[model samples]
Target: MERIELPGFQDLRVQFDYDEDTGRIQYRKLSNKARRASSEAGHVADVGGALYRVVAVEYPSGKSRQVYAHRVIWKLMTAQEPPREIDHINGNTQDNRWANMRDGSGGANSKNRAMPKNNTSGACGVVWDKATGFWVARMGLGGVQRTLGYFENKEDAARAARSERLKNGFTERHGLPKSGLDKPQTLEDTLV
Candidate 1:
């Protein structure tokens, strides 16, 4: 399929009214074979397993193009094209509030992600090294994976991974469980 070029800020503003505070977009008027006046725009769709708000815009040539509502809001509110990547501050993909969205690099975005479902341990990058009988701490930065260290305890390994992540600019929310709480998991925390 051909990639559709995003319409300009002015072009989008003409078609829809964006609410920055709520991250909602509404149609200003009835368009050819599409939304009615003041109707909500966009529908929730799965984008890489996370749900995101997206809208299909009909072009002059009778072709429809889909765009992320966050990107559309960024353009309409800032009068600039959205960055190549945008991070949802709280890690909620559907929350498009102005305060919750920011431009980010691929690495920064990755660092802000929630712990993967496949992770057996409760922490990110702390895994069991069966052969060595140690908890291995590792991390990836800029497409390069590096081992932090090995620990006798999982919490120690988790702490090491967390420390390396912080030192390397990972978000505090990175590796957090789906509950979104920063639970006490490190041995240092218990000691304190």
Candidate 2:
């Protein structure tokens, strides 16, 4: 999804500020601070495995609420609430850096997913075609599967699959190669 700058963050009290360059959000105070000066921002924090700089802000009512540091920064940076799903471009969920965050779609996010736990093929979009006796090259783009082709050599198939993924704007790191299964085995090695 395309990124846009929203304009509702100003509605909230000036208790937090975000630095897009550094991807840091300074929280003026904790939720329990009891309406302290907004000038005193809190330090970076890790809440529930994600980096957060908690802030005490009024939301829904007069009472202040403790919000996620990333969401707070997102609001401050974009002046809007982020989409329901946010993408951490670098694959580091805790890296709430502004450049690392973007409005995310399921298709785009899935394209950045780590290789499946049960992946036997070392390449991203290659699988052995048992019926055809050839390595098949295919790509999944925007939920649509496009067959690249079949090849006798696994390396060639892997190259074809990787190319198809790139042509569709998939990240280079998407479905990164995991094991060494992509390398061709020698006949002698197989005999043992």
What are the runs in model 1 whose C-alpha is more than 4 Å off?
A: 1-3, 32-39, 181-192
lDDT score for residue 184 of model 2: 43
- RMSD (Å) of each candidate, 1 decimal: 3.4, 7.9
What does candidate 1's lDDT look like per residue over 1-192, in tens digits?
123456776677777887778877876647545676556786889877888888776566767688888877877778876787889988888888899898875666887888888988777898889999999999989889899998898988888898888898888778877665345344354211
Q: Per-residue lDDT for 139 in model 1? A: 97
lDDT of 2 by residue, 1-192 (tens): 223333357644356656677665555545555444544344446644445455445654465455555566667776767676677776665567799887766667776655566667766678899999999888877667888999998888877877677677776556663232234444222211
Q: Which pairs clash in model 2?
A: 27-42
lDDT of 1 at 130: 95
Taking all chains together, each candidate's TM-score versus the true structure is 0.86, 0.65
Best by lDDT: 1
* 42: Cα error in model 2, Å: 10
